[model samples]
Target: MNALKHSLAGLAAALLLAGCGALPDKPARAALYDFGPGSTPTATAGAAAPRALPMIALAEVDANSRLDGTQLLYRLGYADSNELRPYGQSRWSQPPAQLLRQRLREALSAGHTVLGPEESATIARTEGRLPDTLRVTLEEFSQYFEAPDRSVGLVRVSATLTRSQPGGDKVLAQRSFTARKPAPTQDGPGGVKALAASSDAVVAELVAWVDAPR
Candidate 1:
């Protein structure tokens, strides 16, 4: 009995050691990125900086369910327009919608009191005035493959500006903006850089368009 017990203990110890050795290594961490222009804005030669429109509330940006996540998405080719793919080890710092909304808010805040939906309620209560509404829907935001080794970053968005009204909301203006930037390296890093540029360009255009005369 003693001999059998000692053999069983020795076998258990060997099995434990082998299990530890067979454990797999940790996965490679995903790389995270954000949008940026990477330089200070140059002063424009103009009169006094135009005053921001009273106040603008940015509504929650709507997007396709797949694009709402942080995963970096890509397309195989134009032939597969409806098919989307995600990179295994690339991701945004935050979900794409949040990132896009934050960028829009920052750009608009340059001269306006940009508020989220929750914050806009306070304005209505305190001032008896509801601010103008800015609604955006992301159409496409991903890296596209033109060929086996060629790609570009593509971004498309639709924006609508609505004014407060007695009976109902009035759409002052709305437009769609699309931008594409060719990747320099045809890989994850290049895609991220190109996407950032496209994002920056569309944001600037959207802000200007929303404030323009109809």
Candidate 2:
């Protein structure tokens, strides 16, 4: 009987100890954002025909520290212009480089024959000559706030067109593109929407530029 009482006491003591640490509050869920589904641009009447450059390859996008990761980045006014920050509870579905490359491929495919890096490489192996290639480096992609309440999605990218040459690949043309669109709301979703619009706008202009006379 004494032994049974001792075992019960020990059980009670263990229960009391287990209850000492109040269950930690669950952490808030992280929000994941992306550009969502994008469609190929429709060909317009009287618009310049597709560029005669044949199939072009899209190299993996390059990015800096601010854009190299998956976290959604932002910045304050001109005072904190150099201070880049990221949202703790918000993140992108993939790295910015990957997202940009996918968007670029989808958008450019409408008006041009765009092959991925692998595709271009395979063609070069068999055909002895690869087509032109478009290499883009994303300099910035983030939400910028002019004031506490006003914000916009800002994106900047530099693109270069290269083609096969006797010695090696030759750069045909290169330029930088920047876009700023007012955010509908001062949150990640707003920034995402605005950025997507800005991206499409840039893609449209780039496609036209490629087909334009040099």
* Candidate 2: segments with Cα more than 4 A from true spot: 1-22, 40-53
Candidate 2 positional error at 209, Å: 1.8
Between which residue pairs do clashes occur in model 2? none
Per-residue alpha-carbon lDDT of model 1 for 1-214, expressed as tens digits?
A: 9999999999999999999999998999999888854445788888687585778899988998878888888897856957898888989998777788888888888778888898888888888888999999998999988886788889999988898788989988888999898888777888898888888889989988877766
Question: CA lDDT of each candidate?
Answer: 0.86, 0.82
Summarize candidate 2's per-residue lDDT along 1-214 as a digit string, tens digits. Answer: 9999999999999998888766677899889988887763677989886544567788898998768788888888655977788878888999978887888887677666888888888888998877888888899888888887888888888989888877988989999998898999987778787787777777777777776666
lDDT of 1 at 182: 86
Residue 202 CA error for candidate 1 (Å)?
Answer: 0.7
Clash-forming residue pairs, model 1: none
Least accurate 10 contiguous residues by lDDT in model 2: 48-57
